[model samples]
Target: MPTAELPSATPPSTAVPAVDLRGVAVRYGPAKAPVTALEGVTLTVAEGEFVVLVGPSGCGKTTLLRVVAGFEHPTDGTAEVLGAVPSPGRGTGLVFQQPRLFPWRTVGGNLAFALARQGLARTERPARIMELLTLVGLPGFERRRTWELSGGQQQRVAIARALAGTPRLLLLDEPFAALDAITRERLQEELRTLADVTGTTVVFVTHSAEEAVLLGSRVLVMAAEPGRVAAELPIGLERGPHTEVAALRATPEFARLRGELNLALTSAAAGTGEEGQLPPAS
Candidate 1:
């Protein structure tokens, strides 16, 4: 059976720069009845920092991501990627829970599509595409159709597609949520290694505290349904195998943080019936 993992409520932080959002606000519909997703949400993530956003499902975490990706405009405040207002096709890469691959295109071709949109030179594009595949551990799977790969492999392709732009910041919204436990854990490890190797700034959204602790340098606890950063939690740990989930989880610090986050979720659920009504899924 499936179970929910818990997290501590309080989080500590350090200053830096992968992404910074100052007073960002999102309202759907009218001004009076507008649904506010995020407000006065100021955060700074340094280069190469792996920050995870954890919260109740409706907290607008995805909306926050859409805003940062320049897919949705913030009704108030600003979202800056590398010191500039983020624009679509800008130096910001996005990975969603679904692979969203183009069925008509081969894996390599899908990547090429992204690079082509950026106007990369023809001569340089192929090699770059190959490198991206290899980086995501999909080497030589290039000519394969998107549907040919397994769920995990398809997500790898998506990551490659996201990196096709060599983005300054990578935004991922529960990309591994839909996978099986084993597969999800494997991808978590793969992403950690990739983060170390590429020094890419990663902003990830996840519901699993274990996943967040395993992959994040810092975890920002959020409340969904008009999502907002309610609290922050720092893993204060290093990256490594989970050989013992029960054992590591037994530590006082880990348990404490987990409980705190769980409480935040409880609070988020209290007022979320309103926010969840806006979209099919908030």
Candidate 2:
């Protein structure tokens, strides 16, 4: 297999934040009565930071993720990734709630297609495919059909395929929401490890406060009816491979942060407006 360098629209730069959004808004429908999915969203994700967006349904969590992914443009303000306006084919990878893999192709075949698009040569693809499968904990399962794997395994493949492009920023919209509790927990740990190993900046969207607390270095709580950031809480708990999952969650700090975030969500839903713009956690 030939090794191909991942294509990047913008060169790497530590000076630029992984993501920058200022007073961003997204609206749809007619000029007379447009649906506002998001409004007054201001966020900045530093390089290698794991940030989670949590909010109620229709709060525009997914909409904000799409804005960063370049699938949707904001109606106001600026959105930038890696120092430039977000664009498709930029150094970013996306994983959705469902594992959107091709059933017709084998796991390896699916990965091969992505690698080919990255300009990796046919001869170089096999090795790269194995490497990716291994990274996603699917080692030597390349030849298996997508339909043969369990849902968790299939999602792993989807994640591996996303990483095949070697994205500098990884955007996930509730990727593990559909999984069972046990499977979701396992994937969360794996994702944390993967992030540490790859140093890829992550912007994850989830409705679960526990998931947000477990996976995010910092959690951004959003409110509905024109989504906006309501609170930002930093998880000071230990993370990555070194941390014990059950023990960490059981700690006092973990519980405290989780409680705070839940309160923020509750306030947002109740429309108290009291939690309207807490300063970003330092």
Candidate 3:
């Protein structure tokens, strides 16, 4: 099948992109009967952009994220992050669907662990942990044990831990999928605000079109059989410091955009191998 045509990965400016992938592919098992996980995938995520990958299960969203995180190597083509080849501990942070925290540690301990890896001095860790917690809306909760916190709170601590290393790129794979609707929506808004405040480039994966539309500055819809991008849409919502999620969701423009993304996702799940007929980004 011909690779779907995606929007150009290059940014409007000359600055190097946070992620650059060209003809990237991943396959597994015997050569004769190799199962292709991703094929002819090309993507570029600009610095400070919140890019979301939305697709059904088995569409290689997590696989693509792992490729960028340097946890998995591509079988063909080149992938670069921060203008260089990607590898573990290369100025990137990751959050999985589960809050993979150290069970023995307190929330502060978790952030301290990451800070220590970044070569922070012991004397400075206390202040830094508080600061990081504040950023995630868990101020002064560092002393709480991981098991003592609720699911959303634990994930907030997990996010703080990831931020301790001051990574330029943050990769998240369905981090809020397990939470209740109320908690998930709250975290979604918080995360969007956090991204804006910190200016961190984010590549998030999700199966929900609503979540993608709510949080992403741009969204990419992917197909399943030999997973590849089936569509790309730039979100043009007028978000500001005062913008509320409820108010934003009630707008006609927001509904229209959501409908468009839903249609793209439907086409991708249908396995038609056809690119979405979206208008060119302005």
Candidate 4:
């Protein structure tokens, strides 16, 4: 679950990078016996970019996400979000593989809790709750108990809660990984649309190449064993308000990108270092 830290005193700035990390590294355990999770990872995410990280297990995808969210600090290098050091509640929203909703709260109540944590006053919460629910395609679900909702619906509520803070950056860690195929696809479409509509910077972590291609404006493939970026691909999908996921996925370009990502992922896992360039989308 995302920590409910108070928003920073300074308002988020659009003038600077949404996320900037320079030669970042993370390690655990004692000084001499530290287990490295990430090494020499430098990444910059501009405002409104949907960046996805995909790699095999033990890669630093989740560690990178944690660093950006201010949940975990990098052992080396500097990380800044919106021109300031990242800290919990500092203009970030987080969602994970599990919905992690408060079972005790009703749908609206959960959102209300988040809104309040983000400094929203009580009087403003009701309207904001309804708006968030509507945005997530769950209009009028304010009264629904979290336990009463299906897995997909529960995740939707979780997303709504995450957005309640109107976060400038949204961090999602395989939020759709646990769902059934159909539900996962639906949520993927919804999430992509939501990101566009909200214009929020996002860093999503997943193991699926298809999901990376489908959602990210930029896809990063990381190599494990002291994880580092092995490949970077820009998803140059031409999209508009009316673009549909089904139509987009059926295109030859989508297939090519997916194939490229898969090959890169394989190479990275094997430490082959063969596929690193971003070829022309044409």
Candidate 5:
């Protein structure tokens, strides 16, 4: 038995889900020519838990994230957040792979934009923005323009903006997929701290198995094209530096787990990795 120490599941005390998906499916265009982005999917994210979904391109990972973020409606089945259907700006925050900040806005202004939606008082926006920047280790970066910052820094600002609303649910769609190794690790550490501090529920999508293993309390591996959950890996690693990339990569167990997931992902991609046989890619 692997001895990794992950966050515990909800104890017997409470049972309400922060987010729930039951037999959800999506299709575009006419029913006969429907493209299944997700099919018969079901999952639950408990309050303050972090769940990561890993899959290759065209696996409907983004579509799933959007469903939770309230950006996309499911064609069938139920998807709810906090016991209600989520809508745009409904206590959910989103961070994408790109910063997507307004070119005209400064870093502070971008975050202020999120706060403004909640009708925060004018006098409080700056303070809130500053606090967020500091949280992402971008202190004193309030005056920096979007184009002026490096790619990694821009992502930090994007995350800060998403967090501006003090959202109960935060959805990250490959937000750090583009960053280099060092930057990725730094941001990952900061995110762990942020999650611990705020008790925010997070559902993030990624292509890397190692990332999912390191940051997530539970990992859901989705199959490509008409994405569906193929395998779920619970992360039992202790928090802090051990959660760091080097520490994780240094372990033989890590390598073995990564190999398992790689095989799982490879199978997921070809839609035939089940039954102990690898399928040819489509």
Candidate 6:
């Protein structure tokens, strides 16, 4: 079977964006002394596009993801996912830094729980569970306890669980941040493949420039203090089954892109009241 193609950088003119935010802003605390998490943030994510938000800590990366997930309402502007206003547990799948799996349930059972919540029939759940497990490279792990798996394996299960609901969009908040270098790289490849195969639009938040460059079709760099978009860079690297990741990373173009992003991020951090702080690698 032919591998699925990545979505084009240019979406069709009439296509409705998977996510649209217009002059969005979020504030916390009382009206007397409020904290601004985001300000004048306007963004649109095309269908099947994998967009990464990268910035230093407290840049409102997580806040932006929460707004899109409908967990938090923006104090200022509009936030929309799949055309209408987004709501929790609707058309969106979320993966956090931790696996957040049910230790009481087996790997398969955890996925089955999500599928069941989606209203799948009991008789059809097993096959779908197996398919999801396989998709995350955890086939036949249905009976295995969540605690028995390695950290990376547990995270794979988490990703599978997120996919169980068949979400149109996936919101990941540094899901691979805690893993070791090798494990993180492997998961990154798997996630890229999974997104291509499912054509799931993804909005991932991370502090790692390498992660952003590798996973995102477009990288949006945000700045601190009332976080806002500072730069947008489209990855023009070739992506296909034949492309070797190591070779791609070794290329001068990859280094150039990474440097460009690092500079943009550094520049955004400058004069933002949090100067001299470097971006996190994980």
Which one wins on lDDT? 3
Q: Candidate 1 vs candidate 3: which has greater lDDT?
A: 3
Cα lDDT tens digits for candidate 4, 1-282: 111111121113456789888889999999999999998888788899898999999998999999999999989999998888889878999999999999999999999889888888999999999899999999999998999999999999988988988899999999998999999989988999999999999999999999999999988888898788877877889888768788889998999889877877887888884434433333
Question: Clashing pairs in model 6?
Answer: none
Candidate ranking under TM-score, highest first, comes to: 3, 4, 2, 6, 5, 1
lDDT of 3 at 193: 94
Instruction: Give me the displacement of residue 79 in model 3, in angstroms.
Output: 0.3
List per-prediction Cα lDDT, in the order shown. 0.75, 0.85, 0.88, 0.86, 0.80, 0.85
Q: Which of the numbered candidates is closest to the native, going by highest TM-score?
A: 3
Residue 72, model 3, lDDT: 86
lDDT of 2 by residue, 122-230 (tens): 9999999999999989999989999999999999999998898899999999999899988888888889989999999999999999999988888888888878777
lDDT of 3 by residue, 141-232 (tens): 98889999999999998888888888999999999999999999899999999999999999999989888999998889888888887788
Candidate 4: where are CA atoms >4 Å away? 1-15, 274-282
Clash numbers, per candidate: 21, 4, 0, 0, 3, 0
Candidate 6 C-alpha lDDT tens digits along 174-255: 9999999999988988899899999999999999998898888888888888687766777777789546567679988788
- Displacement of residue 42 (Cα, Å) in model 6 is 0.3
Worst lDDT run of 10 residues, candidate 5, spans 3-12
Q: List the candidates' TM-scores in order.
A: 0.83, 0.92, 0.95, 0.92, 0.89, 0.91
Model 1 lDDT tens row, 165-211: 88878999999989987787678778878877888889898888777
What's every prediction's RMSD, in angstroms? 6.9, 7.7, 3.1, 6.8, 4.5, 6.1
Model 1, residue 107: distance off in Å is 1.1
- Point out where model 2 deviates above 4 Å: 1-14, 275-282
Clashing pairs in 3: none
